[model samples]
Target: MAKRSFVWGLGRYLILATAGLLAFVAVVLVALRFVNPPTSAFMVAHQLSADDARVRQNWVALEDISRWMPRAVVASEDQRFLAHWGVDVNAIQAALDEYRSGGGLRGASTITQQTAKNLFLWDGRSLFRKSLEALLAVAIDASWSKQRIMEVYLNIAEFGRGIYGVEAASQAFFGISASQLSPQQAARLAAVLPSPKKMSAADPTPYLWQRVRWIQQQMAPLDGF
Candidate 1:
């Protein structure tokens, strides 16, 4: 009887602890909807690893950014951004199918998922990390507006080794502010997003230019944004 009682008590404790943690996460997500985060998990990680290099990031309102920038990213990263609810099931299935057919495994993370990972999680390909990222993405999607998610993503996304956000990236690459970025400049910046550390928006290789052109072509359809 004592052994059974101990097991039941431990189960109850685990359940209560899980509930408390979930409640805390809910409260934080709700608060972040209104407040601009001072720094994200990615930024902190970058700073810690940089040894002394500065991480540059400038927060700007959605209105302060060129309309082209958002359209370009939406085109390049997640075309179904406005339609999907946090996760893109079709994209995930497609990626899995490709992997099964002897193709390399690729990511199908949505903008919301990327935002959640950048803001709160570490960089990794582990299943546990992916699951946590997905849960956070759903929570973030439920709490924030579509515009807010884009705004936060644009600000927190890594553009170069130390550069983050449209504002900093634009200045570094084009000698212009994010608001002054032309369509070509925005497309170039968006093109480097897939591998920001390796790809250079300032000096595009032939391959990077191809991505830039593709992103530019895609931007036309999403221009209404």
Candidate 2:
């Protein structure tokens, strides 16, 4: 009788704990729609680590950032950012088809999805993490505007080892403000998004230059979107 009572008590406790956690997360997500997040999980992690350098980040409004930047990232990362709600089903289908045919695995994460993960979740790929990311992405999309989402993404995305956001990255690499970045400079910054730590906008490798050109080509179609 004692064992069964203990089991029931534990189940009740778990249920309450889960509910409390979900409520907290919901509040935070809703709050972010109005408030610019001062930092992210990645930034916190880096700050906590003794070996990692201190992070550099500056918040800027979407309008203050270059027009080319949004277009470049849309072209380079998720072309369907405007259309997709939280997840891009078509990209997921294509990725699955590629994988089943013995092609290399590809990421199908949309900008919204990446924003959710970077803002609320931790690093690493796992079913659990992806599920959480999907849920939060939905919440973010439901609450935030597309422009707001882009603003948050640009400000929080890690551009280099410690450099965070277009403002810091532009200053560090090109000695320009985020608003002053030229088209070519924006393309170069977007090109390095896939792997910022390995790629450098200041000293572009052959592969990085190719990516820069491709992103520049894509920018034309994305204009005024």
Candidate 3:
């Protein structure tokens, strides 16, 4: 009797899950039809104990992404995160062009793609994962407002091995809230994302400083976009 009940419950969930997916797809198709330009990317964070195994970043507001993180993340990841939609086709193409022949791979993953992968999938490098990453990116862009997309990215981006979100990054690095990050301070924090344990916003390296300068250059073009 218990086994039968479990099976019934699983079946019910499967049905509901299917319905949810279909609804989500429908909404996305409608959004593509309308296609309003995106605003900002923001997500809240939740502080956690150092030893906790879950991600540490959290979301707080819709406004934090552009104001605090835009310059910083653009410096660290893609300066073109805003100019493109969910994917950076030029970056991808350039990467592919630069790849060593058949082995040439590209960084087509945009902010939306990164957010989708980080939130729902496992970490690793593979074509299969990339495919899934792209699918989720499109789905996310379809469903979320640009502001919402940024919100999720800031919240989900892994700051440390265990740390995540702007909130956690802010507290861990600056002992402040995400709302309080200055452009320089934010750039320093963004630098740590590639290797959180090695570098720091509080103590940046020459390379990070150079990267920061480059990101500033990117802002002008992005602003025009």
Candidate 1 local distance difference test against the native: 0.93
With a 3 Å backbone cut-off (N, CA, C), the pairs that clash in candidate 1 are none
Q: Where is the poorest 10-residue window by lDDT in model 3?
A: 39-48
lDDT of 3 at 15: 100
Compared with the true structure, all predictions reach lDDT values of 0.93, 0.89, 0.66
After the best TM-score superposition of candidate 2, give how far the Cα of residue 93 lies from its true spot, in angstroms: 1.2
Q: For this target, which candidate reaches the highest lDDT against the unseen true structure?
A: 1
> Could you tell me the lDDT of residue 56 within candidate 1?
92
Cα lDDT for residue 144, candidate 3: 71
For model 3 the local lDDT of residue 43 reads 20
Error of 1 at 170 (Å): 1.1
Model 1 RMSD in Å is 1.2
Off by over 4 Å in 3: 1-55, 64-66, 100-106
> For model 2, how does the per-residue alpha-carbon lDDT over 186-213 read when each residue is reduced to its tens digit?
9999999888889998999999999999
> For candidate 3, what is the lDDT?
0.66
Estimate TM-scores for all models.
0.96, 0.94, 0.69
In terms of TM-score, which candidate is strongest? 1
